[model samples]
Target: MEGEINRSVHPIFTRDPEDFMQYLNKQVSVLKEDGKEVTGWVYTIDPVSESFVLLSFTDDKTQLDIVMGPSVRQVSVLDENSETYKKRIEAMFRPPEVEALSEEELEKRKNVLKSWLLKNRLPVQVAGNNGELLSISDALFIEPPYGVENCRSTNEIILGRIQGLIKNMPSDQEEWC
Candidate 1:
């Protein structure tokens, strides 16, 4: 009932190194003429079969027959069950939380927000005072790394405490995070 859906969308790539790109223009023209063009959204294009894709926003599950450079292939569709679909959608790009990551997950709350709200926002790299790349890798490594931190100043205090806890670690260990 729950699994990744990698529906094929026709036009998959082929192994012929020499004839690979020969059918490209024709394929595009066909898809366009048929009004079956890929909708404007991000879909994972298969490297070998450029036609195959994992489309996430279709209205329903169905296979598409696509004419590729010089051939046609049937791509299969694997729709996730509703429950699994909802969960996957929810977990997509979430990152670990700092104060809470110390535990496990942390639901985003109304009170919790980004720190960038109160602080000055700047680009990742402009010349630092030294005119060199000011690697904000620290911000990158810290939980909630970079941008403005959410939570109260107390959350910062907690983060500082965690940092203190790591103070005694060996330099090699400390180099991490």
Candidate 2:
């Protein structure tokens, strides 16, 4: 909840797309005008209309819900899972591979990946910079992959490590010191 926004007070509908995009890919507890609460990972925000695309996973199925901006009363970020969620969203709608993509196409993909990682506060190390790693507290460094399948496997491994870490962490009361 580091950067929680109270939409009732701030009027998110009137905010710019850059502001709305801040909530993208993070786990959030959203309160609607009708008083109903919904929790999910933010997938994206429509710049034109400021609507939120949220993703919720249950069992084997994944559900995507769109909450209109005007109806949102508040949005409280639950956790920072933006990087993982972004990867999930990308995998869902990724375009088929072309035999030979142009330089511009590669650059575009790189920029998109870099932007998402930076926005999510995920640590990243450029592939060809002598392989020198950059470390951030409580952050994991995932190597850039060559293809979609490799990226998916890397994500799964990272997720598994995260789950294991969560399971081993001290409880709230124990960390009060």
Candidate 3:
């Protein structure tokens, strides 16, 4: 009977990492075997087992819940988080301890940040021998120029958009190129 219910809901347990990645940092409704619903922002998905970790925040405190891979009946993404909410989530989950950085580490981080800024074509000004800063507007609008390259098939356009979205996601750890 439970197996029947799970099959009826959705086969979420067998989904791939990319499929599960779509729910990350977004509010979702998870239907359980007993017909109860749990809703929260998806924190992470276990790539090996495909289980889900959800986080719920209240005025007084925050709560974290884990739903086993086989027990997840169905998942429906509810809403996307705003930039402020994304920052809050990142800060909340950041490691509690702050380690003193060595000069080598500081130099490496600065180089990475500079490379990222240059790749994005953001206006940057060198501040000193070892550091740089950039002044940005509260909102910057960019209008993509339409051309033959922009006129792609629906499927192609959608794939490109998805790839771009994935590329723009924040990484907690440093990625070496």
Candidate 4:
């Protein structure tokens, strides 16, 4: 009975990733196993998981839906022309622009962060190739720019504390770069 239901849903379950590549960027109608229907533009389909990321746009807001492979019974392309949502979709997940800092400026930031950590009574040492990484008690490690996001650790409590410290630490510059 289960296999019969799957067969009735759609052959998409057995189809290859390349078979669904044609649906990318096009508006599509997805029929679910439970008989629910969803219509949206195809952002991407995970080649591994076979899940679909769908995009829906309103006047000022854009919504995203992730449909699992197993839940998707069938997928039908609604629009073939890609020009409409192509640019908007590309811009949706684009990283925000940031000014590039010079080697000297990066080094200065690193030094300031190390000093701040030491002042906080947290042991910190410069490590990594070209002394680019900061090792905190050989536990947490921080990469360049030395912001809280650069922190890496398995200990969630220490990581949160370190991130908090970085966030509240006073900066010499007017803008806490």
Predicted candidate 3 versus true structure: per-residue lDDT over 1-177, tens digit per residue: 555544353444555558877887889889988888888888788876567888888899878888887778999988976342554565575433212334465456445544554566655333422242221121211111111121223365544643353245345423422
Q: Is candidate 2 or candidate 4 better by TM-score?
A: 4
Point out the higher-scoring one by TM-score: 2 or 3: 3
Clashing pairs in 3: none
lDDT-better candidate, 2 vs 4: 4
Q: Mind sharing the TM-score for model 4? A: 0.48
CA deviation > 4 Å runs, candidate 3: 1-15, 82-84, 97-177
Name the lDDT value of residue 112 in candidate 3: 54
Candidate 2 lDDT tens digits, 7-48? 574444565667776787798888999999888898778776
Pull out the clashing pairs in model 1: 11-51, 12-49, 12-51, 13-48, 13-49, 13-50, 23-69, 115-148, 115-149, 116-148
Candidate with maximal lDDT: 4
List where candidate 1 sits over 4 angstroms from the true fold. 1-43, 46-113, 123-177
TM-scores across all candidates?
0.20, 0.47, 0.48, 0.48
Name the TM-score of candidate 1: 0.20
CA shift of 89, model 2, Å: 1.5
As a whole number from 0 to 100, the lDDT of residue 154 in candidate 1 is: 37
Candidate 3: residue 126 Cα off by (Å): 21
Give me the overall lDDT of model 4: 0.82
Off by over 4 Å in 2: 1-14, 98-177
